[model samples]
Target chain A: MRHYTAEQIAELPSKYRAHFINSCTGFKSANLLGSISEDGITNVAIFSSVTHLGSNPPLLGFILRPTTVDRNTYENLKKTGVFTVNHVNQNFIKEAHKTSAKYDGTVSEFDKTLLNEEYLDDFKAPYVQQSRIKLGCTFENEYFIKENDCHFIIGRIQHIYVDREIQAEDGWLNLERAQTVCIDGLDGYALPQILNRFTYAQPDQPVNSIKDLGS
Target chain B: MRHYTAEQIAELPSKYRAHFINSCTGFKSANLLGSISEDGITNVAIFSSVTHLGSNPPLLGFILRPTTVDRNTYENLKKTGVFTVNHVNQNFIKEAHKTSAKYDGTVSEFDKTLLNEEYLDDFKAPYVQQSRIKLGCTFENEYFIKENDCHFIIGRIQHIYVDREIQAEDGWLNLERAQTVCIDGLDGYALPQILNRFTYAQPDQPVNSIKDLGS
Candidate 1:
């Protein structure tokens, strides 16, 4: 086992430290955030920080790095007040990752990559046609992380589009079946296989797989 | 494709809605947070919201649901000002999931589950010995998510203990090699296999896998 104190981690090469810190957090969500500028330019970028905030209100949040640099997705969403979160599946991992390249504001990632932009139900924002599962969301709020100068942007799920086959009767999504790839670090993409799904846990009772319920 | 509008989602059965909303965000990080109270009562609980905030300060944050119920992990870390984030591996998925059972403050999840707690280097928190990668962190600051009454707790990484063999020369840890599992929904566990690690993206250049670099 290798032990690294805060000083050692801080002193490491900047690029190496970024990789180490990013990967140490564990697997992150892989999604392409689709937005359209008011000028009719569509933008798509990959994000790994999307997190479920509350189910009751169907709220989700993702961390955005400081806006010191030009952020096309942020600017577009701020102007339009809506964006789409599309799952990055195994089939389009390369194209999805390509969206991360620093293209200028004038150029849309959809034009540069193989990802196609599809407008769903006049949602004002475009969705990735290749995504099996996607969400149409409206910007709700943003909180500033003073420690890191990052922004935690919150959005409310306004619409959900998913392939009917991948959803269970109980509403759980089999992401593996959807072929949604997860991010290992900044650049490592991994496909996951479902190992087990357990039932709701309770004290003093054995944890049993939901498979035991024969669902 | 099945489409669910916001109104339709809001009207869903509570359990079904929870599952639907939770899994839609994509894969989440799987970690067990270990903390001890000042009086020496230890607690461990599974968390899926752990996220990388920044690298310069080596910051990480996780969302803690509203403190309406007893939150031992939050309370203990608050008291001791220190805690540990341990990656959940394939071997201990069941044990890690069991920690979600509402174990009271008097009873430690470590005692009830198969997890063994090992104190590392005078840190106030206990690290899960079964976890291949673990970090000791101190409470840095927290922001209240007013929209949902959740707390976004930030922690500064103080100490990192990892298996050297799993890390690459670039300082990225192959989480797949560590057998670290990712959470699909609230209860599903999945093991991931790396498909490819791409190099940094650049405009006008093809996205190439790191394997092409012969690293």
Candidate 2:
């Protein structure tokens, strides 16, 4: 099958068209984010454009790319408006994919990798303590795409934590019981699993499972 | 762990706060959009907010949800501006989650699902003949996300297809060898599995993989 056109994806090459348009929109959502710096130097990075934008004021968004250089989590969420996303699993996907490496703006990818920073509740951002599904966000709005200078941002969930046996008594969670992880283009990393949950779709039926419609 | 705050997730229960804020932002790309209706009828649905907004000029976006009702893929992309995005595999995740079953706008979730409707080459939207990564897109801009009346849209990436043995010689695309499927919140689904790829992270190095730096 393999086709392409759009002038052969604009004549390929540029890190192979950024790994073919970042694995052409499929499994992305590995997290990490974290942020800190108003001299508290904390950073943490890895983000696969975290999405889920609104669950009623619970918002979430991510995209960031164009700060062109020096984007310590967009300058620590513009000097501490807080941040923290976490997730990335299969036991710390290589220190959360080496927190996207580029390091140094006063160092501190949680002191170079095997990730571990906490702060929570008083959270001025910094929470990957092994991440069994975290959150804390806040910042709240940025937009700026204009066709590609990335940015997006948008946070807001103010603290969540999880891991209560991977949630689900209706508050959902259970990312395959928190083994989370899903990225694919900017360097793989998978681990999903939950193969079915259906129920709530109708038009004349034939798609059941939410445990056979026990819902 | 199970903390929650942000005033207990804005006091839960809007369908358990949309299944706990759409499975707390982790794995979501699953697709199947299709479109085509300025009288031609074709539709196809399911979308877990397809993300990836940029890859050079290739863009992609998704969010929709607030047309109040009759959203035949947002009135056929505002009347034929084009559409198609497909991926969502494991042999069509229950006919792509039963095209999010709402039906009626002259009912056409690709003629009641198990999807099939090509059109191709002359593309005026209508592709998912059982997708293995697809594209076609065009719309090109919408935004209107005033903090939650969702619309996003974007698009552009004229035609792509993919499946030549799940790509990767450097242009990535191995979404776990195309078994695709991810969306875990408004009806779960999951599948992923790669586990490692790394290799372009730098900060004094230590991540490796991309099948051991074969770049």
Candidate 3:
């Protein structure tokens, strides 16, 4: 096992450090954050930081790098107050990954990549037509991380669109059937297959799979 | 696509709603948070919200649901001010998942689960010996989410231990090679195979795989 102290990690090259630090956290939730400017320009970027903040209010949060550069997603989200979070699947991994390419404010990634942007139910932001599961969200709040200068953008899930077949009767999503691909580090895309879904954990008895119990 | 509005989602049964909302976000990072109390009792729990907060300061964050229930992980983390984040790999995913079972405070999850605990270099926390990648972290700060009573705990990475074989020259980790798994919803564990690793995207050129460029 190789161990690195804080000092060593800080002294490493910026690019090397970025990759190491990003991957060290483990597998991240991969989502395409789609937003549009008031003037009608759409922007979608690949984000692996999307996290489930709360289930009661259906809140989700993602970390946004500092606005040192012109961040179209942050700008548009703040302006329009809404955005869409779309899951990246195996079928469109390449196209979904392409959105990470930084384009100028005038260019829409949808025009260049294989992804198609569709407006549904008059939502201000566009949703990825290829995504099997997607959420329409409105900005709830933002908090700045004093340690890193990054902003934590929290959004409330307002609308959910999922394929009927992939959803279970108990409301759990079968991501394996949906073919949603997870991200490893910055660029590695991996397909995930569901091993099993266990029931709510109890104290003493061994953990039991919901399927086995129901069967 | 089946669509659910906020109102519709709210009307769902509590357990069903939890599943629907939790799984709707996307894939989550699967990690075992190892923490020890002041009295020398160790605790390990599976966490899906471990997120890369930033690389500059090398910070990570995870959400702890309302402390309504006796959360040993949260209580121990606060008591000791240090913990370890260990990635769950295929070899020990079941062991990692079992840590989520509500064990009594006196009974360490490490003793119950198949995972072996190791105290490396006298670190306040114990590392999962089975985890190929792990981080020794110190409690930095936390923010309470108003929408839900969840607390966002932030920790600064102080030490990192990784198997040298999985570390790439570019500082990226080949998780597929490590047999690391990604979590689907609460109880589903899934292994991810690396499909492709792309280079930094450029607007002009098409997305290129790092292997193709480097090879």
Candidate 4:
């Protein structure tokens, strides 16, 4: 086993520390956030921070690094008040990752990468055509983390489009069936194989697989 | 493709809606949050909302649902001001998920489930002996998400213990190698097989795997 105290971690090289700390947390959800400038220049960038916030209002949130430099996705989404969250799948991990490369403000990543853009349901933002699961979200709210100059941006799910094959009868979407990729650190992508789905847990009984119930 | 507008989603049954919305956000990092009450009782619960907040200070955050009910993990961490985050793995998915079973406040999930607890380096909280990657963290700050009655709790990484086998030369931990499982929804666990690790992206160059560089 390897051990690192706080002091030791702080003394590590910056890049090495970034990779170490990032991957140490565990697997992160991978998605491409698609937004468009007021001029209609579309921007798509890969984000690992998209997290499910709640289910009642169908809200989701992602951490936006401080806008110290030009953050086109933040700027565009704030300006347009809408953006799309597209799941990065196994087939397009390469193209999806390329979206993270720093491109000029006016130059759209859609044009530079192989990822094609499609506007769904007259939504102002563009969606990655290859993503099997997509969500059209409206900007909700953001809270600034005082410990770090990061914005926790929240969005409301206004619309959803999913491949029919991946959804189970109980409404759970089979991510492995959808081939949605998860990110490790900043660059490693992985495909998950569903091992088991348990039924609603109870204190007195042993865990039972949902498959055991013939679902 | 199945399309659902905001109204349609809001109209679905609560359980069905939760399953739909939770799985739609892509795979989530799964871990067990271990905390100890002042009276010395330990609590460990499965958390899928754990997300990387930053790397420089080595910070992580997770969403805590409203404490309208008995949330021993929340109360213990708040009182003790420390907790441990242990990654869920392939071998213990059943035992890990069982942590979510609502046991009485006096009952420790660690004792109820097969997970054994080991205290490390005089840390107030207990670490899961079965986990390959473990983090001892101090509560830093929390932001109240007014949109949903939830709290985004932040923690500073003070200690890290990892199995040596999963680390890469450049400091990234190979989560797949570690056999860490990702969460599909509330109850579904999946193990990820790493597909590729890419080098830092540049706008002008095509994506290249780190393996290509012979690292």
- The model with the greater TM-score, 3 or 4, is 4
Q: Report the error of model 3 at residue A151, Å.
A: 1.1
Q: Is the docking of candidate 1 incorrect, acceptable, medium or high quality?
A: high
Kindly report which residue pairs in candidate 3 clash with one another: none
RMSD of each: 1.7, 17.8, 2.2, 1.8
Better of 3 and 4 by lDDT: 4
Which ranking of candidates, highest DockQ first?
A: 1, 4, 3, 2
Assess each model's interface with DockQ, reporting 2 decimals per model. Answer: 0.89, 0.33, 0.79, 0.88
The global C-alpha lDDT for each of the candidates, from Candidate 1 onward, is 0.90, 0.81, 0.85, 0.90
Q: Please state the interface RMSD for every predicted structure, separated by commas.
A: 0.7, 13.8, 1.2, 0.7
- Calculate candidate 2's fnat: 0.87
Q: How many clashes (backbone atoms < 3 Å, residues ≥3 apart in a chain or on different chains) does model 3 have?
A: 0
Query: Which lDDT tens digits does candidate 1 get at residues B113-159?
Result: 99999998889899999999999999999899998889999999999
Worst 10 residues of 4 chain B by lDDT: B206-215
In candidate 2 chain A, what residue range of length 10 has the lowest lDDT sum? A206-215
Looking at model 3 chain A, report the run of 10 residues with the lowest lDDT sum: A206-215
The residue ranges of model 4 lying beyond 4 angstroms of the native Cα positions read A68-70, A212-215, B68-70, B212-215
Q: TM-score of every model?
A: 0.97, 0.34, 0.95, 0.97
Residue-wise C-alpha lDDT for candidate 1, range A118-176, written one tens digit per residue: 99898999999999999999999999888978899999999999998889888999899
